[model samples]
Target: MDNHTTIAAYNLAKSAYANYGVDTDKVLETLDNISISLHCWQADDVGDFETKSSSMGGGIQVTGNYPGKANTIEEMRADLEKVLSLLPGKHKLNLHTIYGEFNGEAVDRDQIEVKHFQGWIDWAKKNNVGIDFNASCFSHPYAEDGFTLSSKNPEIRSFWIEHVKRCREISNEIGKQLGTPCIHNTWIPDGSKDTCVDRLGHRTLLKEALDEIFEVEYDTNYMKDAVESKLFGIGSESMVVGSYDFYLGYAIKNNKLICLDNGHFHPTEQVGDKISSVIQYVDEVLLHMTRGVRWDSDHVVTVNDESLLIAQEVIRSGALDRTHVGLDFFDASINRIGAYVTGCRASRKAFLFALLEPTELIKAHEDKGENFERMFLLEQLKTLPWGAVWDFYCLQQQTALDNEVIALVNDYEQAELLERGEVLV
Candidate 1:
């Protein structure tokens, strides 16, 4: 799409939206301020730079091994740079503790420090992006039993507690240096695969561990903490220690952020519905946007109904400023960079579509009990020319348009990914 054609289409869209009292200009402006955090694990299929022999546990799995997995710190950084270039808005990078630059040394999770991630900090500064940190509690020997913070073994639990404390400290430093508060999220795969009678015991231990880990306070300006819950994973079918109820109560009591992952709930559960409810209690909430095919499959996100509803709810609840949006999925069956671009773009497009909605008009009708009118307007919104506005936003941001993404990704794959020689059959 040329500049002239984009501008003409956007002018039409702007005019059309004005009839419904929605300002296209203001929508675009709001979209510009929204930043999505790109998960670093996508580049390497959750295989970090650590020199350990631990296999992926905790019900976390990555499927399809497309060629060109980043095996080194430099390669991961380069891949992230490429992904940023393809995205439209300024975004942050989310890093797991395992992805730290270990410099060919064996640094256990509990032994990691700020120096190991100084390289990443410098790189983030160079790219003009902020960083979010995660404690890699899974895929370690201590977590093989599907427990970390909630482990019954005192030694194992203490190790994970130490690791999480270090992660928070590192996150604080990263935010202090970059002048953007780093959101450090903690998620563990602690659950029982079969029926268990000791659920309360595990929850008690987990709560104690968290209280101890968070005992040391850091400046909120530099770091904000969030706890993520999972419905059930492969080994955690019977029960999960950090269930949504547990975390919600913990967050509300502690005045901390609660992370609501789209793929972390039952199939019938809608994370969007929980957004408005959760925000009323917590000061802010973190969102991990992903697609789950019948389970927590961690598939790349798409601009589907669920995605749209999540964005719509965020906007409708007037919690846009209080929500921290981030992407979480690992689909190695396709090109890694393509996954990043596709998922990130889909998320942004969902938000863009939500912003383009005539929300005020619809809400006014609902307020007056005009159900038919509200339903009709919402149906009509599905066919609006929001795509034109989206294209113009992409044009303004100087990013690849939807039609051009395939060719761009293919070109990069041929030049970079195929040359890595780590093709998975």
Candidate 2:
């Protein structure tokens, strides 16, 4: 905490007009002033494009692909080491599996992990590298559409449980040594209401799988069903966010952590209230920071996009109780550093902005028995189309772009591949 005021977030732009106002290196220095723990670029950090999209005034809608410029631990570690050199001290790092393999691209390929999670741990430990924690989800070939456990097929579910549990264990061990928990930000791509029951099945599937995963009692005497049930099971519920409140309720009922992904709430739930419910059930919640399209939940974090409604919920949750921040983003074709640096910097600012707001605003509205957060937004909604306002916001953000190195960032708000330069885009 050398520069408590400088502990804000930062991003890597690779010198492009879109990032004209921010210097990649300086952005690192700036983190010290804002007191940021990590940088994030969930949605559009992995791809490269030549033009901005008119759809959202940020990124275009491309074929299936997740963003964030990293493919392997070696690449990610190199990028991380370089970023750290720019800014120093007690910082955190996060890369996500959100929209991962965007269109099944990350399909559990051996290349994603040349070795295994344990292999990376050994490599890091042997090199004496200062290890950091990771937040992840599966995107295996079996996940052609979704992860195995997300499937109804019992065989697939069994296969997925082992992979998930094994990885989770390794992640936990790594995090424990580094003083962080391997946060699991789960969001079922099990799309919403294809018909009705189609998606509803996701609920039951998740419940049974989790309960079974965590069913075994450590003690032989505590085992359920005496002779029929497994003996050494631990509910996998801790790593999931229930498909439905009932399923989520099951997790909470079993004392499991209900991880929250902000992007998943988009086009659906109210940020503040929804987050409050999660807070009521789970003590530790991971903040999924990614942007999206109108109906499609894209994971990019363009500063101009998003209503900042979700951040408000997180702030309130943090103020009222406890919560954990998990910066989530992917680079479909953009620079890894840029995805993390810029996304994190902007998010930290948004969070700080909320923190600076008077408690009375929420309280005063609450005093009058009104949902001030909702009321304030409601008042704005009455007259504003949000489009015009958003345009104005974009114009304002344009000025925040840095020019010295701005000319170098990918022109199209695409994702990055610097971390995976040795592999493929």
Report the C-alpha lDDT of model 1 over 70-177, residue by residue, as the tens digit. 878888888999999888987999999988887779889899999999999999999999999999988888998888999999999999999999999999999999
Name the runs in model 1 displaced over 4 angstroms. Answer: none
Span of 10 residues, lowest total lDDT, candidate 2: 224-233
Candidate 1's TM-score reads: 0.99
- Look at candidate 2 and tell me the lDDT of residue 19: 30
CA-lDDT, candidates in order: 0.93, 0.41
CA lDDT of 360 in candidate 2? Answer: 42
Off by over 4 Å in 2: 1-73, 84-90, 95-115, 118-139, 145-147, 186-202, 216-247, 266-268, 296-299, 302-307, 317-321, 331-336, 361-425
lDDT of 1 at 357: 87
> What digit string (tens of lDDT, one per residue) describes model 2 on residues 249-305?
654576544544445443554544566776676554445455644433444465442
